[model samples]
Target: MSAQPPTPPHMTVDEFLVWASERPGRHELINGEVVSQSAERAAHWKVKLAVHVALLNAVRAGGLNCHVVPDGATVRIDDATAYEPNALVYCGEEAAPSALTVDNPVIIVEVLSPSTGRMDRARKLADYFRLPSLAHYLIVDSNEPLVIHHRRQEGCDILTRIIREGATLLDPPGLEVVVAEIYGAS
Candidate 1:
């Protein structure tokens, strides 16, 4: 008897949303498969919270038409993929408090954990840059006082900077926060 061909388990974006909502924890759709995000450590949480607060403060202080959101809100990368960044900044008239997903994010932040470090730095980085509205992608290291900032330049070019002790400036959205502020007593 010939073995039957294995059925594909891939899911579309709509199907992923339905499938993921029934599950208990945070999930992402990558390559048409559901991926559960790792539970963060206390240090990780601290950094994440700090980053959110800093960005929020910046937006408030500058009176910019931008909003900072935590991980619960998803960003649709394509028909087969979506991600919930640790924190994100969305601009323009489309940002609403009631929205569950954001399609245009100006800034995306991720707190690096050992479990997801490689993926965050590699695959996720590539996926996020695909969004035209994305200007900066910050990877904060919880283990050290460091942040890797990837700033999008004109016409497909990108500028990268590593911040250890000084502040990193995020233009287009107009925000500046020191690297130490992100670790914030964690």
Candidate 2:
């Protein structure tokens, strides 16, 4: 008897969630495949911390009922795709009680790393913009004080801004965070 080739493993979104929950480390579901994420560098962590703190502070200062979450909090893109953003904010009823994952995120931030920069800029960018509640997608550079802010406008056009310094107003949530504050230089 001739041996046949092994069948490629495929998992549904529900299966991936159940399987990933029992495993260690970080993993992302893309196109029905589980992909392990690499360990983040020091620079990446620093920038992520700054962004997380800034968002939390903004929510507190503004007295908004928004919740700021760091990495490990999954944001479901669809049935077969989920991502753990560097930072995210969920306001009002979108904030889950158990805090498992967020379905409606107002802002999602990603600190770009060399390994994931390409995917983050292209694939992730396209995927994240699909979230109807998403108002801003901030891609921060860990090596420099640069922030690529993508804000959805009146229509479908996204207003892109590259901020090295200064501040940008987040309209829907009505919070103003300076570029320096996000980089931990302020």
Candidate 3:
């Protein structure tokens, strides 16, 4: 039998970034371990695209100095953890053209898939909020017509709202995103 390659050791965020850059496909560093993201279903992709477009349009309509980035941009959570959200919004000055990581993201969006649903609602929710710059974390359900909005409140208190229709008003950055637009019905 052929010899198998040795398993890589747990890596710090910086090391994982360097290693992941040389590899193919998408990967996330979770608590010092490298976890490869699985293939997504069509429904997941559809919602992801819709969320990206909706956020982009909102930014443009509001004329805010913010950038909406789709998947492939990483957000560092800590020294040993980082996440690559399905979509994200960062305000003020834009990052460098070649930058692979976003240091400050005001809004983060994730389209839930069967494999990642649990983590998205739990682990990711907790981790994303750890960043002081994060104001909103939106979890879009691929199997249902739902969007869970998590907004940061005063002193670590997070306000969670389940939205099935209408719009979500994201203040601070001052932007509004209609639920219908995100589901692509309008």
Candidate 4:
């Protein structure tokens, strides 16, 4: 058998950004370690795209100032951790053309797959909320018509709602996304 490649040294969020930019596929920095993301199945991709389109339409129809970004933008959770959400929205100004990270996102989205479901529901639910600017965290189910909506409330409390039909109201950024529109795009 051939010898295994040596593991790279632990890296901070800054270092991970530089390293990830140099490489090709998706990667996230979790607790100072680089975690390579697995290839997404077609279903996962469809749902991800659907959510992006839904959020984009909502932003436009509502005439909100927020900018919606599809997958690939990194969100730094801490000094040693950063995540590339499936989609995200940030108000105020548009991000710089060369910026690698989003400093503030009012809404963050993740489309669940078999491999990521647990982390998305548990770890990510907790980690994404750590951002002061985060008003909502949406976890979309790839296999079914469902969305786990986590909305930040007063103080440190976060309220979660499961949306299967109708619309999900995202305040602060102030937009309403029709559930069917999201799933229909897939």
Against the true structure, what is each candidate's TM-score? 0.90, 0.91, 0.95, 0.95
lDDT of 4 by residue, 110-156 (tens): 99988888999999999999999999999999988999999999999
Question: Each candidate: RMSD to true structure?
Answer: 5.1, 4.6, 2.0, 2.5
Model 4: weakest 10-residue lDDT segment is: 1-10
lDDT of each: 0.86, 0.85, 0.92, 0.92
Q: Model 4, which residues run further than 4 Å from truth?
A: 1-7
- What number of backbone clashes does candidate 4 have, counting pairs of residues 3 or more apart or in separate chains? 0
Instruction: Give per-residue CA lDDT, model 1, range 46-159, as digits (tens).
Output: 889989998888888889998889888888999999998899998888566566689889999999999989999999899999999999999989888999999999888889
In model 2, state the lDDT of residue 112.
97
Instruction: Report the lDDT tens digits of candidate 3 across residue range 1-186.
Output: 667444377889988888888777899999898898999889889889989999999999999999999999999999999999999999988899889899999999999998899999999999999999999999999876799999999998999999988999998699999989977674
Question: In model 2, where do residues sit more than 4 Å from their true spots?
Answer: 1-8, 94-97
* Candidate 2, run of 10 with poorest lDDT: 1-10
State in Å the error of residue 35, model 2.
0.9
Clashes of each: 0, 0, 0, 0
The true-versus-predicted C-alpha distance at residue 166 of model 4, in Å, is 0.4
